[model samples]
Target: MVSYGLEEKTALMTSLTDKLASTENSLIESTGRLDRIKEAFHRSEARYHSLEEMERNLEGYQEGVKSILLSKGGDTSPLAGIHGIVADFLDIITPAPNIPNRDNIEGELQAEKVIEAVLGERLQNIVVEGQEDTKKAIEFLKSNCAGRTTFIPKRPRPEKYRIEGKALQQLSNISGVIGPAMTFIEFREGYEALAEYFFSDVVIVDKLETALNLLKETNSSYTFVTIDGEVVESSGRITGGISNGKSPGLIQKRRELRALKNELLRLEREVSGTEGEVERAKNEKVLLQVQIENINKQIHEETIRIVNIDKDIEALIDDEKRIQLRIETLCLEERGIDSEISNLSSELNIYNEEIQRLLAEQAEGEQEIQGLIESQKLGRERWEEAQRGITTRKLELATRKEKRESLSVRLKELGERIESATTLTTDKEESLSKIDQKIDGYLREKSGIESTITDLWQKKDAISKEIVAKENERAGREERQRLSEEELKEKRRVMEDIKKEINQFEIQKAEIRLETGHLKETIYTTYQINLEEEIKNLNLKDLNIDELTSSLTALKERLNRMGPVNLASIEEYQELNQRYEFLTSQESDLTQACETLHKTISKINMTTREMFLNTFNIINEKFQYLFQLFFQGGESKLVLTDENNVLDSGIEIFAQPPGKKVSQLALLSGGEKALTAISLIFATFLARPTPFCVLDEIDAPLDEVNTERFINSVKDMTGFSQFIIITHNKRTMEA
Candidate 1:
């Protein structure tokens, strides 16, 4: 019965052990699933946060649109008139409730690139309530000096392009034609005009080939956009290609954000369910463990009971052996008594009483022996039964031992699994800790970089202000120099006029001297008299000859008829000539100073241009090299908008990645732009190495291959420049 009980208990324990193992496995699996779900949820949550930040910052919107949206307060606010961006108002069309698959058209329509290609920059066009609102918004944008933005008034305007009636029907009948692009979008009431303005004359097709065929067959002016974002314009120009991992458009970002949010919710629910399952399994495991322990205890008690039975059987066997020995001694003594009775027959009369007593004792002895034999037989039977019981117990014990060993082995396996799980958990925790440390370090570095950038911006502003002030000073000096030059020219002209007057006076004086000399010679020859002595001798009171007096009077009258003449005219002419000479020297000095100033300015400008061009050439060379290195095969160059006016001209970058046409930097896709910018930056660094360079997610848009190139480039520059890179990419972290 005990063996049976032990068997039952063993079976129960084995079942419990199995249950525990299964529960343990279930718990482990559930825990692992929960962890996975949690990881997914965290990733989704992070994505949602990033998208939310982008939306909040109005990252991809035009500057004017963002300005208007952000300008929600104050008297000059255009927020009242603003109706948000076109992308915000429009939604991708979903299938009807009854249609199950709907040919998977909804997914194709939801491709942001398709809509983006169809609308182009129009997606960022600010929608307004009316023309008045647009005007107000424009005025606000202008007042704020915000960048330009296109506005679409919600009020209907005259349709510029439309496919109607037969044309529309014919186009719709074409194979692979989805419909007008407008049909793939949904918008609120009163936004139809805005939608039609962008979507009119635009058709969506499944393939570029279909769009091309439609365009060729119709021979009409229409814009066709393939679902893959290829655009065939009315002018027969085709623009299509895969972009270099550019960030999704705002519409796509919104859609992705929504999807991530849904995914996060689903994961959260799944995590909760998994946790609950784990909890249930844990509870079952605990219950099974308790039952298993209780079964073990019962099995232990049964084993102890079997052992005690074995001890009692051993004691009974020992007692039977002793009793058999005593029986043997009594039988020998009875035989001796029989021999003595035959020899002492003569003495039988005398010992009659003694014989009767001996018989009585013998009878008692025989009865006792019979009782002993019966007891021995009972003991033997009992021993035999104990032996059978012991055999059965031994088998049961062996079975129990086997069960215990199996349970022990299973428990040991569970322990090993638990230890492995613990080790894994420790590793995961260590990894998490390391990641956290890295994050903290990155955050600190980011903060430092931001602070540095802020300081640099402040310094830039200060430098710009100083430059403006210097420019203003230069302009003021130029104006003063111009006025001084004009004054010097006037002074030079006056000096020239004085010189001409002096020359005329000298000529007149010479002519008058010659005439006077001729008169004196004629007087001396005709009258043989000295004119000077006569003039000294003659006076008004003592007049000499009447004819001479008359001539003198006529000469005096002629001189009086002319302008007044001073006897100090020679002295005055000498003084005026001295002043003219001084003025002439001053004019020469002023002219020389003006020439020197011009030369200085020319030298400065030449030096500035030489320095700028030198730096530009070096950077451009490095840029070309780095561009090729980054892109594997590409050409890029830096161009001055006006090389003649290099100092004031804008720099334009023309980049042609491998197998691509040369395009302006702005026209490149996001990843391409990032790579291009990195090339430019590294080129500059090579040209003028700085102490340190700070890059904030510069590799975010780059793919793995390009990121590797970028890291390598950075490593190459590590000899001279220290790099502070802030990124979340695992590859970047590893590097």
Candidate 2:
């Protein structure tokens, strides 16, 4: 029974030992698998976070689209009609349950790059409900002075381009050609029109060569985009290149984000499964250990029993041998006493009875020894089983030691990886710090350059004004010189006239003297009185030559036909000469005053022109700078309607926002006009900062992002100017 029990226990122990070995191996494998799964899970999680962050930040979106998305606050009313950008609606072609070949088709087509290449910049285009929404979005953009963007209406416009049936048939026949580009993409329900609008004339091919072949085989009215993002235009232009993976396109990024999310989920599932497996393996290991301990305990108890039985059988054999030796000695004594047999017969019979009892006891001792031998054999078998169990345990221990070593190695590797990661992180941080330092240095340099430019602009304006003033002064001097020359010529003419009059007067005086001489001679001949002596003695207050001549003519009336003369004519001539002299003095004074007044007016006009040109130039430079700031990039200037007449010339503002044509202020969109006007105002402020400024809803047209910029600008001016801004915008109010 003990042997049978030992045999059963040995079998069980052997089986348990095998189970324990397998469990240990399984536990080791499960632990390794769990670690791998956990590592993969962490990696996937990190990647998912990175992609999520990228999406959240709108990293690849255009400036205008980013602005729009960022400015759309919790309230959806303003952006209610907006259906997001075109890229948002596009997705990778998914395998449909009904289509067995869908995955194959999807794999063959590079949907992301193909769509990205086909859509081009239109991926950033905002989709709107209609023209009204487009108008609203435009207004929003203009108000914010955000960058410009294109808009696609939800209501599809008439299709102006369609692939010809014959061309389609020919394309289908062409090898390596996918169908229309639209067929490889999936979009939202209402965005079918947009898809069609953007993809109607585009075809997809597997390669550039295939595209070229297809183009040659068919009418050259289709634009083909290859799977590698190469493009073949209908106008016989081909563009093909490799892309550096630094900045993956927006569509590619979106695709990667989705893939990352799915991968992360899968990793999470795998991790959970692995963790469960590891737990089960550990539990099994614990149960096997318990079973092994119990088997060893049973083996130990059976060995102790076998050892006790062997000790008992040895003691019994010793007693049996001693009794046999005693019986032999008694028989020898009885043989020597054979002659006295009669006398010792009774004693001998008693001794024989004792011997018989001793024999029976010896037989019983042998039977017990045989049973103990059988028990020893069973115990020996159990000992061998226990030895096998020990061997298995040693193997298990070795396996466990190996597992521990493997875990240690894995841990060491993980530690090394962590150290390397830490080192890499440190290096990245150092690099980032260096980059930041470089950026700061560049910013400082940029600021210095800006300041220098401003100073240069100021110097240029000052020099221009000085030059204008000098020109005006030179012009005035030339004008004054011309007037002086004309005045001197008139004076010379007057002097010549005076000389002619003087000569004529001399001739007339000579003739009068001759006449007087003749008269004197006649008088001397007739009345013998010297005329000179008579004239000197006479009181000639009223005496006139004509009157005297008349008297003489009367005396000799017939000698000459002299005209009649009045004596008061001499006084009248004297009065008229005095009046002419007074009038000439008045004319000279009036001319001088008029000349002074003309000079003053000219000075005033010149000063006004100088000031206007100076201010205009300064404002123009500022406007150009501010326009570039507000619109991100563009050109703008203040033009004079009439350069010849700066003082009275009208200023025409010409502005060109980034990605737009140069247009007059009136021709720009409302938001563009607002931004342009705001830029002008800011430029004016910068040119001539005021002590205090009042802005009433100036930011009303601006979105949140633009309002933030406006606020920042306002803050920059707070050092020199005070601003009173009236606004309803939350961002503005918060600022």
Candidate 3:
């Protein structure tokens, strides 16, 4: 029985050993796959760093371009027309005080606000006139500015002015008037020519009565304008009642800058997202490693269990050998008792007692059997525990595999984002190029439309004039008919002679009527509108048939003398107008694009300033802390060379060493300089430690005591970092 049990135990051990070996092989294969996955993840991660480098290069390019655009004649873009500097006088003279409510979100200054401050009220039409054509001059009340309208035509000054130069001072009490254009302080400076060309003869007044008075007084030379920007031309013709907003030129550059910044920010976010994906892949890899570690630990534990089981089996065998020796002794005693029973019959009773003793020995053997059963139960428990561990590890291994697949999915997603970002950038560039190429064609079409519109307007004006003249004649004819009807009714007997005359005159009138119809048909053919409708709407009396017939003949003769009028201008104008609208839309889109570019540049500037300040602050804090530590007791600080603008400044360090007689670092000893620098270096390490740091001959200037201190400080930091210090100092090398 013992031999059979030993053989069974050996067979079970052999199977468990084989199973563990197989599990280890599977783990190794899984580890290899995990390593490959991690390598791929790391490669993908490197792309994020490359993107960061690209972004830095792009920023450098952006800055260079911005500098060029800001320089005089740096951007000679004919389409943009950025000719010269335009500085607001108010900003220079009485710079606007900060008002929280008045923040310009887009960083664009409206022309209305500017003109109101400089020229007077900007209610309707009057904003800064020099800012392109804010509205159409011909369609004065309505606004359309397709062409560059530089100046208002000159008009004669008012003949009888009421307000004089000094009287203007008293009227200035009104809320909104600035004096004449020339009165502005800036107007007297470099802007004199500009003001003279556009606003020289103009006067601004607050009240209409003041304007009238100014006009009356300015019969001397000036035209008048009310505070709301109503113009009283010197010739008595008034213009203006529409408002123009900010000029395109003022906002275009900044808008373009901001647009570029927006794009850069978007790209940065895309890169950041990809970085997150790489991190996730790394995390998945780490998780798999952890699971693998746990499985290895489990395998190690199983080996320990198997060794303990072998020891237990060996202990059981030793106990069995001792039990066999005891059994052999009992059997020898039994044989002796049988020999004695044969020698003496009287000793039969003693033999019965020996049998009872042997029965007691059999009870001891049952106790040994119970011990063996308990040992078997313990081994079974250990085997069951190992099986559960193996099952749990397998589950973990499967989870790691699932995570690997998930990482693959994330990598794919990251690749897609990169592709999309690339495609979008390419498309945007191509679209902008296309727009630039098409602009010249748009300009030509726009010019043609303007010419056609001008001719159509002239023809319409001529027709309006003719209609007004005919209406006046019809009114005169109606009044005469009423007088003539009364005169005819009073002379009834003379009416018969009049009737005969009227009948004879009617024939001549018919002939005149036919001639007038022909003239109207010719007029209608030339111009779409006519005076016929006005005449038909009127009720006329035929009291002067003879005289009217003679007048109509004179008109017919006059019509024959007049040349034919062209009727093609209207149709040509309509076609040109459709083309013009299409071109205008394209131009508007181009304008928006320019504005976006300006905005992007401005945003980049703002972001750069903000980032610089934040980095400067963090570095300053670290430097100050490090400076004091290096000195052992003295104070130090870092400050910006220019406090107002971080982007345009450099950093400055101020430090004082311990026991220094003087205030400045220039007074520091050689040893003190090395110590201060080391302190600063260590402080930086504490703030942002790299993977490895090297100091070359950093302790050369330090004495034995300070060198030992430096080496010791470096040693204390070694548990979390690696440092290589090169020095000829024996003490430093020993430490």
Candidate 4:
């Protein structure tokens, strides 16, 4: 009962174990499902994050593009003027410049400087009247303007300067050259005219000493400048100092943007290389797979051979067992036959002994008959019966002998059959043993091959994993490439947007500047006022019309209430205005006459000054060459004494005589003065070409050397003007 109870308990435990096992299986399945769900959740979260990030990035990109065009709350960009499609392409192709102060700057040197920077000096030069170098710059800019400065400004005529051949690159003493004044302002294309007009003559030098030297060397021909922003006038005077130049940040930003484009090109090249490597890896993996297929084919053939060998070994074993069973059965039969023959032989031997005992009993019965005549008959009868039994025993012995002989023959046959069966079994067993050995060898070889195949499979699996990893890496790289492409596209889109905005800003800036200039010109022309200064601090506010009307009505009512107060004052004012008009008319008539006289004088003065200027220019040109001839080697120039007032300006001669410090004309010797006077008279005559000239002892105090110079000077002017010389010196007369 205890054992039975123990068995029952064991059965119950087994049933519980089975149920627990089933529950474990269910739990494992549920866990796998949960793991898959978790993985899916993670993937969804990552995707959502990526999407959100992309959205933010896109918004930022758009804002950045917009900001590139916005400055001072206005869009003075080239993109504004350009058509939409072309502007987008323009962004991809060119480096756009940033204009500063689009809203507040116009008709100033700063504005022109910005224009020059955007459109380049060559284009600005073309847009403004300038020297030969300027024209050359214009041509150069035109030749190279395909991808740069898409917008151009209306032409402006600024003051002309003779910046010629040797002057083009002759910023020798320049400390650092700032661009044309157009480079400084952010106003649009039209504003370039103002900058060009203002900053045309600015040239920066290294130091004050350099500026002074430049001023001295060229007679301050250009507006010389110091690096610290000190300006030198053409008359060797300095003005403006201490950093008057604007920042070059806009130009710097343009260069940086160009650099970024170059970086984009470089990264694109790298991406191309990565793509090629990925393609190569794919090709290599394909080759590896081909090799794996070939190996698999060989392994499959070997596996089939091993299976066939196993089947052959099993069949041989079955045949050997059948042969062994046959041999054992034959051996048992042979032993049974031998046992039957032996039993027959033993029975035959017993028959022979019985027969002999019967013969002895017959002899004993004959002896007893002889010994007792009276009982002879009973003895003979017993003896005869014994002889009869002996005869039967003899017959039985003969039959038994015959049966033994036959049995021996049968045993011999059985023995021979057993020997044959044993031999056959032995052969079969040997064959079976050989087959087992062969099977064992094949099995061992198969095991080794199988082990090698298992190793190959393991290696293949590892290689597959590596390939999977490589594929994943390639996929990752491809994804990154795709992302990079998307980013590049985004950048391109932003750049296009920026370009369009910049173009628009440029157009707007031009319009705004034009309008501002027109407004100023109109205001000044109509009101004779500096409108810009007046409006600089002015702001307009909206008025409530209803409130203003109510106030006006109240004032009218107050005036009505104070009626009859100004009637007499009005009458008196009207009477006084009539008298005043009569006096004013008389004054006006006198003022008109004075104005007419002043105008006549001014017109006459203007004509005289104009004629003087024309003649002076011709004379000045001749004088320079003439002075060089007279002095041998030095420069001389004619300057205005009162330059600020051209009509009343007096001529001041500046001559650097050869081997002499020509500080003042009064310091010259008498002979030198005479020479200088002759040169000037000759130059003047050459300019206007007077028909007649008379000299009264002009060379009265001349030595031989002076006389020779005098004769030459007279001869030079002999072409157009007749000269009469009353010289005591024979040398002067002869020459």
The best candidate by lDDT is 1
Clashes of each: 0, 5, 32, 29
Query: Each prediction's TM-score against the native?
Result: 0.44, 0.43, 0.23, 0.34
Which 10 residues in a row give candidate 3 its minimum summed lDDT?
A: 141-150
CA shift of 311, model 4, Å:
6.6
What lDDT tens digits, residue by residue, belong to model 3 across residues 375-432? 6654766556655754655565565456546655754665565566556556655654
For residue 317, what is the lDDT in candidate 1? 51
Model 1 TM-score is: 0.44
- Candidate 4's displacement at residue 690, Å, is 85
Give the winner by TM-score. 1
Residue-level lDDT of model 4, residues 201-271, one tens digit each, is 65543345766776776673577544344556786655553334443332333334455455555555554
State the TM-score for model 4.
Answer: 0.34
**All candidates' lDDT scores?**
0.71, 0.70, 0.51, 0.55
Candidate 3: RMSD to truth: 43.4
